[model samples]
Target: MHASSRRQTNCCRKPSTSGAKAPDLGNYAMSLTAALNTALMGLSTIQAQTGVTSGNIANAQNPNYTRKMVQLTTPAVGGDPMAAVVAAIVRAAAPNLLQDYYGATADYSRLSATTDQARQLAEALGIDDTGGGQTPLQSRLTSFEDAVKRLEATPEDTTLKALVVQRGQELAKEVNRLASQRTTLQSQTQDDIRTGLDTLGDATKAIAGLNAKIIGQKAAGMPTGDLEDLRDAEVAKIAGLVGVRTITAENGAMSIYTDAGVQLVGTTAQSFSYDSTTGTIRNTNGDNVTAGFSEGSLRASLDYLDGSAGALTSSDGNVGAMEKFFNQLNSMARNIADVVNAAYGSNLFNYTAGDAAATLAIDGAFTADPNTLDATRMGAVQQAMRNTTLTATQINPAGEPNGLSTANVNIFGLVSGVMAYHARQVSDNEAARDSAENLQANVEQKFRNLTGVNVDDELAQLTVLQNNYAALAQVMNAIREMFDEVISIGR
Candidate 1:
């Protein structure tokens, strides 16, 4: 036989010595092949781990990105267990922490929305006139009172009467300006509600689509880490717009609902509509659920626009604080006009009944001729300003009784009371917003620590994977060399 064939035959031959058995070349070959296959699989696993680590490092700065990990598992092959293999990739997230974050986000958004609206209204009414320590309304009303006092002191001064009429005109002008601004704010709030509803609807649809995709991927045994991250982000956004509850199914599908148990997303998304005119929210079934949202910016805006605090008692119910303030100003203007007309037997101020604040003006008789100002009624008007308790009923912009029975105050007392009330509301809202925001920041940091990628940890994992890759490659190269040597011997 040729030299190479002789060697091959001896390799397969049994030992000639008595009681000795031949070597199992077939089994040895099978073992070598198995070892090679195992080594290859280890190399592939290390490579996949390296890729996962690299992705983590790449997305370290992405706030929405969650850290990913590969699960290693072993399987038996040919009666022996193989090395660990990459079984699945999973996103690292603490469900409890994430849920807490969602709640905090909703709270922060609600307080922020309320605070912004309150601040805007306060500014419009000049309630926050820190520069002068007095709002325009307060200053104008004070000037009118001073003019009245002057006329009281000199009951026959024609110039003083003209001055009183002029002050009344100025005060009426100021009240009208404030009312106009409030109307503008209401319109703007309506627009914002419409826009927010649109955004919420879009978010819900996207979540539903993602739910379908995730369910399909899970069924197909595909990786769903990225999809889950995207879904979580969408969920947070929706929570900020409206209070929500979530449920996860075994199929990896997520269901979303409002605090009021209104389903927002499931296998299919539910559509939403907002009626800015009536300040109503409805679902695809057209059912009114205005009170469904208990937390979120949408709820805050609705509360401010509708003037309903949802109180139980009639004295504090339905009427929003902003609308109540408007009504109080209207009542004060009406009371001033009524007392002056009754005492003087002449109309001194012209105003509509319900909208005195907006329609209040000096009567044409008084404006055309200062001599028409009745000084005889000056004492009664002054008494009304100082001691008369005027009662103003609260009503919403829709002219519905808000259940806030009555707000009682003297003439200038109502003006000061409204101003003070606005300042207090603004202050309280700011404090609440700040507290919620701080809590949200702390919660977000904790959440990031739990689920966010750590650069140092990822780097260490990458180093380990690199070493594993090198070791596996070396084993593969050694296997190749051994196979080549065996082939040479056979030759």
Candidate 2:
């Protein structure tokens, strides 16, 4: 009844050149076999389609899994096709959308690091942004000035003299504590970089190893969708640690590189190292990439060590929040010491000339005996506090400490400026971080819309495949019945 069977029957019915038409058992047998093979081809195609649909449904929740589909093909005996057969499996995804998502992820990580560090600094300095009280440094400065004024009014009060020394000790202790905090934060930053490098090394090695496996699987004509999934997940992980670009070859080997063109993975994986002494991150080639990092957690770490705005650094030739904070503290400490010591001449406060901030302390002579306090110098101390402004270069244990602007500010004003500088940093970096988070979310959603699996769609396809499989089975059974009737007729 089919076209191929009809064609065979019509050919078999043709008149013989010798004159009489004889029964052609061979042609009938071939027709039945041809019908059976056609049904088998349809059945095989249905099986492949079902498998692909099942895989899609199974991976519906997996973001990295790419959807797979069977490409249908047909075989022809002479001119027309017999039945459709699955040619090969292919994966579906938008490569450009995926790359954009990865880019956003890297940017978000960089800004988040910058913002979080600013908040950490604000907390450590006791400078509250949410209408909280003044920084301990600011309050201590006020208390010290008040004690000096009280002592100035009562030249012979031993209790007043002792109070001035007490307040001065508190103020000096606060400066030393803040300067020490910078050193502690520096050590912590180095440790974070070391941990990041370790994670980066592991990701690169895993990606490179996956690349080799993918190449082999693809060459063997196997479905490499799962392997590709693993590789993509690995890439996404390190994308936050450093900004990177990836290119996948036809053979399935993926090459990764920094956005700045530093090759991270080629035929083999690249390794990164962290130097605790210099607080620098280096690639396997020993290049100093700390200041060069444009977008990532590593970039944020560099900013934490310095600052982003018109921040002053110790000697690294870069400016950031921590750098500005450290330099400003040291400058203020030495300036205060120089003026107070010059005016009183009895060394009211003691500090090492090189590192004044870490060594600032109240003179033990005054604390030991309040009677030794020079009430005559109290007026000089007031004049020193009121008239003196930190407007010149000062000692820096690390490097040159650029003093306050030539605006002629008192000690309290200098301390206030440092707080204002950090507040601005927190505001700017937080805004940038919020913008990056929005961009990352938008890009990620776009990627998911384009390539993410749909369970309902796959389930519908599975239902259609089941119906088709049943139809093919019925067609094969009919062909078997026709073959039996012909065999009985031949006997």
Candidate 3:
């Protein structure tokens, strides 16, 4: 062996040089490992991105859908120059615009509810106002007033008195029916609100469980973006039922709150329970309900119906516009009864007097009894009641043409005003609900843009990773060729 060979034989190792066969092969192995890792990471990115796009497309038809996005972070690897390491796939943080949308939802819901209640009341009162028969309450009032004027012409006519009694009964029946209908609608509204809250809470709990699953997988360096999109879809659905705000934590966990700032999920889930029968809503601890962060339409409806109706005040101390209406109706009924009684000496059409309002209620169903009294007197009384204006000038009593006393039927103004106001409110709410639906559509579109999966983007990336992986393999082949040449020379 020459000096270099002798030294090589004694050292029992290859020389350290860039072109050394063994060292070059080791370098090739390292390069291949790096390239392989890069390819794998690129593949994962493509898959995650694809899943997000798929989710967006799937929920396009859903009105309450919110979009989802995948988040990527780099991983630290030992000093390897060529490897690509992906730390985890995360869901996008919620947007600030959602807060604004939720607030609008709350307002619209309440307002719409009030509007709806009013509309229904108006419909019940037959206030289309197009034809004489269309506005039953108004027409009925006119008929009664006409009867009273006829009675003035023939106060002693028994047939006219009977007609007046019949007309009075008809008006009383209509008023009673309206009051009962309002009570039924209010009860139904309460039930709907309670049921909605229960559904919302159940959804929140499910999302919390999903959060745990997603974070656990992420910590293990797995692709959890697909599952994350499902969770987000569910959350968005829940959002439409109630307003929800979210907070992202350091460990890939999320905490949820209601628009009202009540926590739904964190260290533990704060859930709600609703009684369908009683129409009561409460928290997991069975406490009375609070709106919390729920910004959904259900809460909106409750606030609108309750607040607007409750705000209506009448001359009487009763609260709620609906109650005011009932009070006015009762007052009118009393006034009518007093007038009729003074003229005919009988309590024929009085709603129950104070403290015993229940008994004074006339049956909503009316039937005339012609045999009980003078028909002419009854007819005159009925006509006067219908035309009786709230103003004193409308009445003629005890030989006084303008005397306000002894005049009955002024309730026409109160009944018409209260019923009409309620109806207009309902119509307004219907319009508001339509507007809210449009807003919800716009919000969903925004969510889609942020979080939707684009298959084209993933496919493009896949092609790039494939080409790079092929290039790395080619480089390995070239390195092998050089090693083969070195081996041949030694041979």
Candidate 4:
């Protein structure tokens, strides 16, 4: 009886702690949800980073390509630490050191191109034989002039006269040909400018479209990285077409501007127009357009064609210096003939005679008395033709023929100088651009290290996710088994 009473008392005491605590179901569910989101976000980020890197590598060989990068942000969650969201790629932080490299490169390229062409043009004339220089133009001009001089020396020599006439005609034809080539180059430059403008317009439209898509998608709680990359790619293309300065807004939009600080694209798409006849590019309202290229190629091209180095018009309202040079050559040729005819009593050189009546007809092209033909005058004409009033209209205002008045300077000389400079610039910048490209590759590798997808990583994550799913399945099985046991016991 004593033992029974002791057991009863112990049972009655029944450990002061009351009931069993329920499992923290909400905490477990939240942890699993957070982990799942993290894994998904990581996968997305890795894929996006890979895409960006691949795009950069793909365009590595392209002269017009700019490198792209990836942007990431923390997803909006309180408990998740590993979750990531890919944001739009911000404009790359291209080093100004590289820009300087590019700018120098452009200057040199323009110089080289101009100089080389000028040298060739000089050679074409064949008269610039300060030494035994190999210039066809200068030599030919000298040969023609020598023939004229020889005829002057022996006026009765019909063979010499015929020779002078033949050589003169040949020299004239050559000068005309060279002038035509220059004109063609100018026309091509204009076309290039027009094309650049049209391209900018297209790029702007694409960028604007992408911006719209990205903004809308972001609002819908979708990732905007792909759309941002598309927009960045377009912007990079535009940079090659025309150097541009880009600014990023708080709203995740990018704005592009010209070197002159004119806005090209903003919230709305802007339009550009090309005038085929004038070979000019402008905004729809006809404002002269400036390039927004961060690199030097497009800017160099523009400078070569219409920038300060090759300005078509001056502040004083003068026409193109190059055009003026050609025109003056034509004028001087006609004047020389007129003077020779007036003084010596002969139409020895066929000059049409005046600005209106005495047109400069060389190789079937009607030009003013002073035209590009003057490039050959000194080599083809006798000393008498050298007599002239060197006026502003006759020569460049700076007093040399077309302002390239140095002793070694001639029409061809200018072209040579500019071309040479341009070539050097191109060579150096290309090297730097290559280096920058390499840096971009390094950055990409770093990015790959940080965020790129590895098969190993993917497999590991997949395993973790699979195991979690298996655990959930096992828990469900256990719960079902327990419920069955409860039913059996009741039965």
Candidates by TM-score, descending order: 1, 2, 3, 4
- Writing each residue's lDDT as its tens digit, candidate 4 over 260-334 gives 566778888678765544534467566865443333344434444442434534431122433434544554454
Ranking by lDDT: 1, 2, 3, 4
lDDT of each residue in 336-435, candidate 3, tens digit only: 5665555554555555644212223322332345445554455546544555455432332222111023233355664455455555555666776788
Candidate 1 residue pairs that clash? 4-491, 307-319, 307-320
Q: Which stretches of candidate 4 lie over 4 Å from their true place?
A: 1-133, 149-156, 181-183, 276-281, 285-347, 350-401, 407-491
Query: In model 4, how large is the Cα lDDT of residue 223?
Result: 57
- Per residue, candidate 2 scores C-alpha lDDT tens digits across 192-223 of 77788788899999999999998998899887
Which candidate do you rate higher for TM-score, 2 or 3? 2
Best by TM-score: 1
Q: C-alpha displacement of 164 in model 1, angstroms?
A: 2.3
lDDT of each: 0.79, 0.78, 0.56, 0.51
TM-score of every candidate = 0.86, 0.85, 0.68, 0.55
- Flag regions of model 3 displaced more than 4 Å: 1-80, 83-85, 92-94, 128-133, 149-160, 224-242, 273-281, 290-325, 335-348, 353-410, 453-491
Using TM-score as the measure, name the better of candidate 1 and candidate 2: 1
